[model samples]
Target: MFKTLADWLAFDVFGLTAESSMGESVHFFIMDITKIFFMLVTIIYIMGLFRSFVSPEKVRTYIQGKSKFAARVLAIVLGAVTPFCSCSSVPLFIGFVEAGIPLGVTFSFLIASPMINEIAVVMLWGMVGWKITALYVASGMVVAFFGGIIMEKFKPERWVEDYVWKIQMGEVQAIEQDNSLPARHRYAFGEVKEIVGRIWKWVIVGVGLGALFHGYFPENWAASLGDANNWLAVPMSVLIGVPLYSNAVGVIPLAEAMLLKGVALGTTLSFMMSIAAISLPELLILRKVIQWQALALFTAIVTVSIMLVGWFFNIIV
Candidate 1:
């Protein structure tokens, strides 16, 4: 009975034949669907752990009276750890303002939090090489740091909400823990459900985008991008990626597909970083934090940094 059941479980339900084109199409569709589901479950679950475990409020207190440079460095480190989203960015921005951190320093944390979190790094490492993955983290942090500095030079105090100046200082609330084993388990499960539930749509969208690139795009895309022939790919890719927004997990599959399709590594990396850092989603969300002028400065700084990253990576790799 055990042997028979094992055989049954191993059998393909759709009866796709290995040698047939029709069977191959079915298999591809099934695999893409599975990947989409996996991306949703994995990405959001990780974010849930971040929400439940890490506290950005704690970070806000430490930057008090510190050098902007130090805060920027800390921002990069914090950004790597915190699981902030578009919704959360505002409160954090408010917290920074209430704390009297430099304008640029505040921008540093705000910029870093959503663009390059730990979840993205882990996903990048899993999907791409450690070298490329490391580059993503390092460059993202630098972008956040300098991007904030550039924004500070403009000094858009008018962009801040009038109410932020009146906010009284207070400690941030920490996550609650349960003493009972069952309750602890429930808390963990709840985190997963909450995180995954929110961004699951993005999973389907991202994987679907990746699948399109995988199935239909020219096979030589990455290779052509990878080749050092034209210097034009760097700026062109950056120009294209600016209005797009993708979390690291979403972009990893796209990057894999691009690489498979002969997309240039530098160009692809630039595109991924631009979408992650300087995209429309971030801009729209940032509008709630700072006015249009500041937002433009922020975008310009991030775009230039990403463009440089693309060119630098292309030259080195």
Candidate 2:
């Protein structure tokens, strides 16, 4: 349906030849923008309905009472299932700190939350395949799990803002929620509005860039990076991704373009994960809660972990 519309607009309505780069780019842009937005609305609304039952406070409470390993696992699970992006860092971080969640557990949640959401999962499964999606999810969880453990080894509590320790979260308030189906529907619709509003511009930008890549890039433009001997590609991909700030909805289309243009899967995954997990904006937000030392260590550990995941997958797959 979307393809037919794109073709009619680009080739029939616009009277542009399919062979022309302009036509191809137009078709690509229209097709992806429509398809991705449709997916985003449908998936986010469903996830939001499920999310009405859960809250950030509930997440912190669940992790608070568990043993170290159990807490880490629970944190990672909650993080993956939750709809948070890296932009949610400040409030989530503060909540965990105030609740006295362990540094490692909090770190696990922080790492997984932005990197392994349901949108990313569905998008990957649809565009790439279930295998790559599974690998991505598994790698993200592994990185979050061990990354937190390693960060804890640094005794990161010392670097937390003194003010964070001083701010005591008062008694846990059980706010009453309307649990009727209409309320859930309203909540879901609200999420659709808020999330779509936040990411619509990014979706356009990402698809525009992707269209250009798909239409204008040389067929083998990324061939060198795809070669097994090019060890620099994975690290370079991560480095390039660190400064760019975009959610999975924005970056995944670009990633699909890269894949279509012959980029290696590991390098592409590394780029996507880096953008989702460790953007400069997220770091800046985190810096408000933790000192430079802890922030630096967190960055280094996660960066190295992502690089390793990329390198390993590149070798095996």
Candidate 3:
């Protein structure tokens, strides 16, 4: 249905030849932008209804009370559900700490928040398939789960900035929320508005890049990266992605294009994860809460873990 609409607009209405690169790119862009925004509004609103039941303070209290494994699991799950980006890192990190959540478990939430989310999952399912989406979600969980455990082993608390420790976190008073149907609907609408407003530009940029790659990138050049012998592709993808800042919403379209153009599955996954998870902007924000040492360690652990995930997928799939 979307393809038909895009084709009409691009080829019939605009009168561009279907064979032309500009026509194809225009179609790709139109189709994706329309489909993505429609899905985002509908789905995010639904998710927002459930989100009203969960708050950051509540999450912190729950994690603080759970066992080690449970805390890690909860953290990862919450991270995936929350619509947080790197911009929220500093305050979220501080809130977790101030709430007395374990450093390791806190690390898990931090890792998963930007790297994996409902929007990304839905977008991937639409662009790729459930099989690849499952793989992506599984890999993200594993990285967050283990990354937290490893950071705990490093005695990460010692590396936190002195200011964080000095600042006292007072007890939070829980406020009752309205759970009436109308209120829930209002919350859902607000979420749709806020989330769509925040990420719509990213969706445009992402789809634009995807369209360009789909229409103009050399197929043979892209295929070369898929070669089994190209071991460096995984690490190189990670390295390149680290400095770039984007949420999963922005990166998924580019990832879809790479896969369509013959980039190796694992390499593409690595690039996507690195761009969403370990962006330099995120690290710079984290610097305010943690010292240089902790920041370096966080970067190293996530980078290495992402690289491993890439190589592992390359080997198996």
In order of listing, the candidates' clash counts read: 9, 0, 0
TM-score of 2: 0.95
List candidate 1 segments past 4 Å from native.
1-52, 170-176, 220-223
Tens digits of per-residue lDDT, candidate 2, 1-317, equal 98999998889999988898888889888888888888889998998777654468788888877789899999999999887756677778888887778898899888998899888799778767898889989999999999999999999999988888787677789888888888989999999999899989888888898999888987765788776568899999999887787887788888888888888888988888988888677888899989988888988999999999989888988
Model 3 C-alpha lDDT per residue in residues 84-194, reported as the tens digit of each score: 757777767888887678899999999988888888999899988898899999999999999999989999999888888778777789777888888989999998998
Which residue pairs overlap in candidate 2's backbone?
none
Query: lDDT at 181 for candidate 3?
Result: 83
Listed per candidate, the RMSD to the true structure in angstroms reads 4.4, 1.6, 1.8
**Comparing 1 and 2 on lDDT, the stronger one:** 2
Off by over 4 Å in 3: 85-88
Candidate 1 C-alpha lDDT tens digits along 1-317: 33233233323665645455444334433554464455556665545544454476777777778877787888778777877767777777778788887878877776677667766676667566688888878887878878888788888687876777887866666656655656655665786687666755655566667756766565566556667566788888888888766665666667766766777677888888887776576677768767888888777888888888778877887
56 Cα displacement, candidate 1 (Å) = 1.9
